[model samples]
Target: MKILVTGCAGFIGFHLSKHLLEENNNVIGVDNINNYYDPNLKEKRLNILKKNKKFKFYKFDICNEDKIIKVFKKRIDCVIHLAAQAGVRYSLENPDAYFQSNLKGFYNILINSKRFKIKHLIFASTSSVYGNQKVMPIDEKSDITNPIQFYAATKTSNELMASSFSQLYQMKISALRFFTVYGPWGRPDMALFKFTNNILRKKQIDIYNFGKHKRDFTYIDDCVNAIKLIIHAKKKRKKFEVFNIANGKSEKLEKYIKIIERELKLKAKKKYLPLQKGDIQTTSANINKIKKFVKYKPSVNIETGIKKFIEWYKFYYYKNGK
Candidate 1:
């Protein structure tokens, strides 16, 4: 199978593309390599994928309809759309970025996938879509009309838009609601990466919500594995579907930090702070549907996942004396 993965230079996209290539499938990856965080990190990820013979990469923004159409001229079996302006706090600052990438860019992808008669369109959604739902273990059927953050609003819009596309064209679309994803090659903006760096630097780490937030931190590999299983599922494809891909275990923010500190043998100077706007108090995923449909199992625990990430971080960053 030939898979086209947008945002292939990104954290999840990079891991997913590498996994697909390992499965002996041809992977065509595309990313604009925007400096949302660090283009250097994105470049490093792309360079690793370039080494694989089964992988082909394109440098283009997904929002460019012409370039996206040009890339689809070749047969693409399935498309895993992961490109978007990510970050809740960032969205509050620049709402236009979310509109452009999440809304406009997604529209371009959907139309092209429909134009090419693609079989499965697997796209990334977020647990943030749940948006203070007043419940634990959020399900696919949860009320997502009121997204607290503009970023979540864009993703919720993506789900609605994708559903319309699926219905209109009878397309097989899967919107994966990813929980707090963390692991190796993670974005510097993410908590795990920032906390690890701060702890290593002996800087004060800001503990949001007075260290009371609980998140279902899904490991990158586990998240990618769930995606692989869903894409390769032999069942008759549904016209539209949504699933929660998560570890199914909610861990406290403080505990998460403690594990990282233990792994690094460095205690972090903690500064408890109030939760910022556009942030949810808790997030837990109800992944029963995903498991039932695709036998998806999240095997990586938070401790093990953090250890792996720390090892990679040290090797990738510390070796250079940065």
Candidate 2:
């Protein structure tokens, strides 16, 4: 299969691209390599992917219609669009970035995919779209009307926009509402990486929401595997089928911290702060639809995933002398 994976330098994108390449798939990966946190980390991931012969990469933002269209001129089989402006808090500081990348970028991908007549278009969405829903296990049918942050609002908008395109263009599209994804080569902005880095450096770790928040911390491998399954799953051109790509488990912020602290063998100096705006109290995904369709079952638990992350983190920082 010839697959086009956007955000190929990103945490999940890097892992997914490698996985597909290992299976002998021809993968053309792209990323603007924006310095949302550190472009160095992004470059490291891209370098790893570039080592594979089956993998090719282009450094361009998805918002560039001409470049994207040129890439589509090839006989592309499917698209795994993961590029977007991530981070709920960052969205508040810079809403326009989200609009340009998440919204406009998504628009370009959809238009090009439709023009190219790609078979399947799987894009990334976020659980933040659920807003402050009191529900424990969020399903695909749950209401996503109340988005507390601009980031969540934009992600929800993406789902709606994708649905409209899918219906109008008769394209097969699936939006995966990813939970708190974490593991090796994970985003520096994510909680796990931040916590681990701070703890390892003996720096203070911010315990947001007074250490009361709970998140469905889905492992990176599990999330990527679910995506791989979706890639091959029969795509019936339904009007925007959305699934919560998660482990269906929730872990409290404090517990997750303890695990990281233990793994790093360091005590974390913490500052407990009130819940920030756009932050949800809890997120647990109901992955029934994905499971029913693709037999997707997350194999990694929080403890095991954290262990793997810590191992990688140690190696990474040690090699870098940080």
Candidate 3:
């Protein structure tokens, strides 16, 4: 199958593209290579993918409708759209970036899909869309109308746009709401990365909400596996589906920090702080709906996941002098 994967330079997108390429599928990856964090890290990821014969890459912004349409003119089989301006804190600082990438860029992708009559479109959503819902475990049927952050709001808008496109053009679309995704090649803006980086440098790690926040940190391999299973699953016409891609297990922030400390055999100097605005107290995903359609079994527990991440981090930074 020929696949178009946007944000291929990103953490999850890079992993997903590698997985697809390993299956001998032709993959065309696109990314703006914006300096959201570090373009060097993004370039490193792209360099790894470029080594594979099955992978091709394009350096372009998703908001460029003409370029997107030109790419769609090819015989593309499926599209895994993962491009977007991520980071809740960043969204609060720069709301226009979210609008430009998450809204306008999303519309450009949808228009291209409609124009090209693509078979299936799987896009990234977020668990943040659930907001501060009183529910313990969020499901597909849960009301996602109240997003605490602009980032979450943009993600919700993507889902609505995809649904509208599905209804109008009979497109097969799936909006995957990803939980706290953390592992090797993780984003520097993410909590896990920041904490790990701080701990390794013997710096104080900021413990938000007095270390009371909980998150269902899904490992990268499990995320890629779930996506691979969904890609092959049969799709019905005009089916606009949403699924929670998570471990379905919520681990407390302090507990996670302890695990990381234990894994690295180094205690982190902690600075407990109040939770910032647009940050949720907890996030838990109900994956029953996804399990019914595809065998989405998460393999990595938090302990093992953190261990793997630390190993990768040590080798990536220490050995490579990154």
lDDT of all the models against the reference?
0.93, 0.90, 0.91
User: Which regions of candidate 2 fall more than 4 Å away from where they truly are?
Assistant: 235-239
Candidate 1 lDDT, 107-218, residue by residue in tens: 9999999999999999999998889978777899999988999999999999999999999999999999999899999999999989998888889999889999999999
Q: Give the per-residue lDDT digits (tens) of candidate 3, residues 134-196.
A: 988889899989999999999999999899889988899999999999999999999888988
Candidate number with the higher lDDT (1 or 2): 1
Stretches of candidate 3 above 4 Å error?
Answer: 235-238, 320-322
RMSD (CA, Å), each prediction: 0.8, 1.1, 1.1
Better of 1 and 2 by TM-score: 1
Give candidate 1's error at residue 301 in angstroms. Answer: 0.5
Stretches off by above 4 angstroms in model 1 are none
TM-score of 3: 0.98
Q: Lowest summed lDDT over 10 consecutive residues: which window, candidate 3?
A: 234-243
True lDDT of residue 65, candidate 3: 88
Candidate whose TM-score is highest: 1
